[model samples]
Target: MEFTVKNVEETMAIAYKLGKFANSGDIICLNGDLGTGKTHFVKGLAKGLEIKEHITSPTFNIVNEYDGRIKLYHFDVYRVNDPDEIEAIGFDEYIFGEGVTVIEWSNYIKELIPKEHISVEIIKIPNKNLNYRKIILNYFGEKYNYIKEIFI
Candidate 1:
């Protein structure tokens, strides 16, 4: 589904709505450029998952783990040179484990993306006044078809 948000709050709200369905083993891919509100969206997602602590981008650490109503494995591959780099920190186990995973800058390691994951692409529209964003959400595989239908 495609949505246009006039401000950051709306973007977060949308993310929060979808996040209500976040469950164990759910993988979400977030694609966006710098300052496009990707991290903000994830923060809202963490809120939806009932996480109490503040959420920040896991840029330096590569991954951040949080305990909530469900586990959240948040990753930032911006500095990753290779997908294998994550193996040292248990990439497969986290993605396939009992937690919700969100990956930022995922295009760098697209090969690792599962066929059943949810993808969110945020694009900034260049307009002097609005700082608008176009958020596109796409879900792959049968497991996500239900989610797709609901979002549409």
Candidate 2:
């Protein structure tokens, strides 16, 4: 779906909607440019998941874990040079674990991601000061059909 968010609040609202439908073991791959409100969306997601802590980009830390209605594993691979680096950190544990994984810059480690996952792409339009994000929900396997249904 394509959405035009005028500011941060609208972006967060979108995240909240997605978060409400999220389930454990679900993987969300977020693709966007700098300052495109990916973190803003994450904050709303955390809130919707009933998490009370702060949500920030894990760019330096690589990953951040949060406890909510379910576990949330947030990964930022901006600093990762090789997909092997993700493996070194034992990414599979988070990716395949009983938690919701939201990955930033996930394109970097696409090979490691499971086929059945959700992909959200956020694109920033240069004009009009509006944050135009194109969120594409792609489900690869039968296990994710429910997710696709919810979004539809």
Candidate 3:
């Protein structure tokens, strides 16, 4: 589905709603340019998971784990030069683990991403407000078919 938001609050609100449906083994792949609020979307997801800690991009660390109603494994792979680099950090374990995983700049590690996962692409609207964003969500497997309920 496609959604447009005028500001950060709206962006996070949509993500927050989707986050409410997060379940164990769920993987969300995020694609967007720099400063497109990908990390902010994660913050909203964290809130939906009832996580109280502050959320930030793990650009240098590679991954950040947060405890919530369910565990959250957030990853930033923008700096990764090779897929093997991510694999070296036990990428399989976290993706297969008992938690929800969100990957920013996921396109960089596209080959490693599971076939069944949710993909979110955020686009900045050109010639309009800087905060405007067009978010497109695609589900890759039957498990995420129920996400239609969020838009309906």
Best by TM-score: 3
Q: State in Å the error of residue 118, model 2.
A: 0.4
Model 2 stretches with alpha carbons more than 4 Å out: 148-152
Candidate with more favorable, higher TM-score: 1 or 3: 3
Q: For residues 17-106, write the lDDT of model 3, one tens digit per residue.
A: 888888899999999999889999999999889899999999999999999999999999999999999999999999999999999999
* Candidate 1 lDDT for residue 146: 66
- Model 2, position 128, has a per-residue lDDT of 75
Model 2: how far residue 30 lies from native, Å: 0.5
Ranking by TM-score: 3, 1, 2
Off by over 4 Å in 3: 128-130
Prediction 3 TM-score vs. true: 0.97
Reference-based TM-score of each model? 0.96, 0.90, 0.97
Question: In candidate 3, how many Å is residue 152 off?
Answer: 0.7
* Distance from true location, Cα of 123 in model 1, Å: 0.1
lDDT (10s digit) by residue, model 1, range 64-134: 99888888999999999988897778899999999999999999999988888999999999998888999
Better of 2 and 3 by TM-score: 3
Write out the backbone clash pairs for model 1.
none
Q: All models: lDDT?
A: 0.90, 0.83, 0.93
Candidate 3 CA-lDDT value: 0.93
Candidate 1: list runs displaced more than 4 Å: none
